[model samples]
Target: MEIKGLRKIEPYVAGSQPTGKNIIKLNTNENAYGPSLAVHQTLASFDAHQLRKYSTLDQAVLRQALSEQLGVPANQVIIGNGSDDILSMAFLAFFNSAEEVLFPDLTYGFYKVWADLYHIPFREVPLSSSFEIDSQDYLVENGGIVLTNPNAPTGIYKPLDQIEEIVKA
Candidate 1:
């Protein structure tokens, strides 16, 4: 059986893994320093017995901790598996199918994937010749906007003033 939206999606391809012994693996953005001592201690102290039963899905403790640390309300702090998970959830929750979402031509590819999977129309605004995102370009009418701060591979970051301009428009 064929699905309607599946046909349009070009599955994302990750960078190839390094094969040779001297290769410096740059794919997946894994941490070079590995887990910290605090992380190791936390893992060592984890209560393995808790794994036997299902825990509540509410992340109030984590949310509260993050809120205190970040100086934001617990309601505003959402803990997720990763940035991708948070972005995916936000996109699905906030974007409307009737309107178009806007994003840069070169950004985290998953933004398009999420839009496609949710049947949310999205428009890709091209980056400038220097691979920088012009906030003015995003001022156009759009249902939602997703932008990478220090845009991927190119690493061009928009200043706060420019970001404010986009939000104000």
Candidate 2:
């Protein structure tokens, strides 16, 4: 039964997980091989007591480290649990205008989910036959544009010059 004043949403469907030995799980971006020895060592030495407390919301240490490595100010860095979290925040923050956002049709599926969830209009520009993003397609009027470098699933990377052209448009 449908409830009054309730928001209905079409959930994002992820790729299937096939179970078997020797199966490499590319659908979920899982590494074929297990974590490196350094990761294992770090986990082995982790303090279980820390789990009882929540981590800092600002993530100052991580942000500072990332900023130092990237040569940017700590205030300019925004960290999230993952790219999905960051992208979701970005969609909500920047795609508030009535104009439609644009992204590649064959890009990450989460873009559509976030757009729908936030009630942001969007359009999917088709990729070229070679699975390359034609920068010209995104040159048209748009509220915003999202491009995944070394695009997901296809693993095709658009050149920096082409990306700059889209940004300039």
Candidate 3:
């Protein structure tokens, strides 16, 4: 039965997970090697009892540490579950305008999904013949821009100066 006023949309289809021995999965950004010794030690020493309680939303301590390491102010640091969570939050916070958001024609598929989910207009600017972002393309009027350095699938990294040019445009 079709429900009234249902928002039907195409969901993001992640890359297939192949199972096998001695296989490294890069599609999902799975670590080629297992976690380092520090991670193992941390997990082993983790207090399972703490799981019963919810974690603090502010994450002040972790944010402060990250800010110190990155040489940024604590207020500028944002810690989330993962890049997906951070990106989702960013989409919600930004990209509210009549102008269309601009991103590469080939990029993480989630960008389109987020835009669709939020009802934000977007345009997928085609990459150069060499599969690199043409900063000139982004110079046009846009609500916002999302450029993934060391882009996914293609693994092409646009130079920092070019990115700055686009930002300053």
Candidate 4:
């Protein structure tokens, strides 16, 4: 069997870099400040012997710290490589061969791509004229609904209570 169609996919083009040494980087939303003092201290004093061990990506200590910070159970918390890892795991859990996923047209551009790659149905629900999703619209039909909290370039955030209600319903 010949593997084909891979070439048809468009390569993801990331944002550009700063031209000069003096240019303050603005494209990627990384922290301008250095790593936390605790993180720095931990890494600086990390034992070399531990490097020989094989631990799963789900490191317990980090997960426990995050769970404590979020006030949620470690089982409920998920750590990922980045936003894409979160998307991938969610799709894996919420979808299968015969399921449809719904997403807002205005949010994360990469969502539809993931659905396509996974062979899951992807529906683009248009936002209201003001470019915001009413919870009612998202609740209608979806195996899972994907949304950005503070939204995108506009940076508008919906209330948490409303988001919780939509997800629960």
Model 2 is weakest, by summed lDDT over 10 consecutive residues, at 1-10
CA-only RMSD, every prediction? 2.5, 1.5, 1.6, 3.3
Rank order (by lDDT, best first): 3, 2, 1, 4
Per model, state how many residue pairs clash. Answer: 0, 0, 0, 0
Candidate 3 vs candidate 4, TM-score winner = 3
Candidate 3 residue-wise lDDT at 41: 100
Local accuracy of candidate 3 as per-residue lDDT tens digits, 1-169? 6689886668999878889987888787679888999999999999999999988899999999999999999999998989888999999999889999999999999999989988889999999999988888999999999999988768998899998999999
The candidate with the higher TM-score, 1 or 3, is: 3
lDDT of 4: 0.77
Identify the runs in model 4 with alpha carbons over 4 angstroms from their true place.
1-11, 16-19, 23-27, 97-99
lDDT of every predicted structure (CA atoms): 0.83, 0.90, 0.91, 0.77
In candidate 3, what residue range of length 10 has the lowest lDDT sum? 1-10
Model 3, total clashes: 0
lDDT of 3: 0.91
Candidate 2 per-residue C-alpha lDDT over 1-169 given as tens digits, one digit per residue, 9 for 90 to 100: 6799876678988877798888988867779788999999999999989999999999999999999999999999999989899998899889988889999999899999999888899999888999888887988889999899988778998888888999998
Per-residue lDDT value at 74 in model 2: 100
**TM-score of each model, in listed order:** 0.86, 0.92, 0.92, 0.75
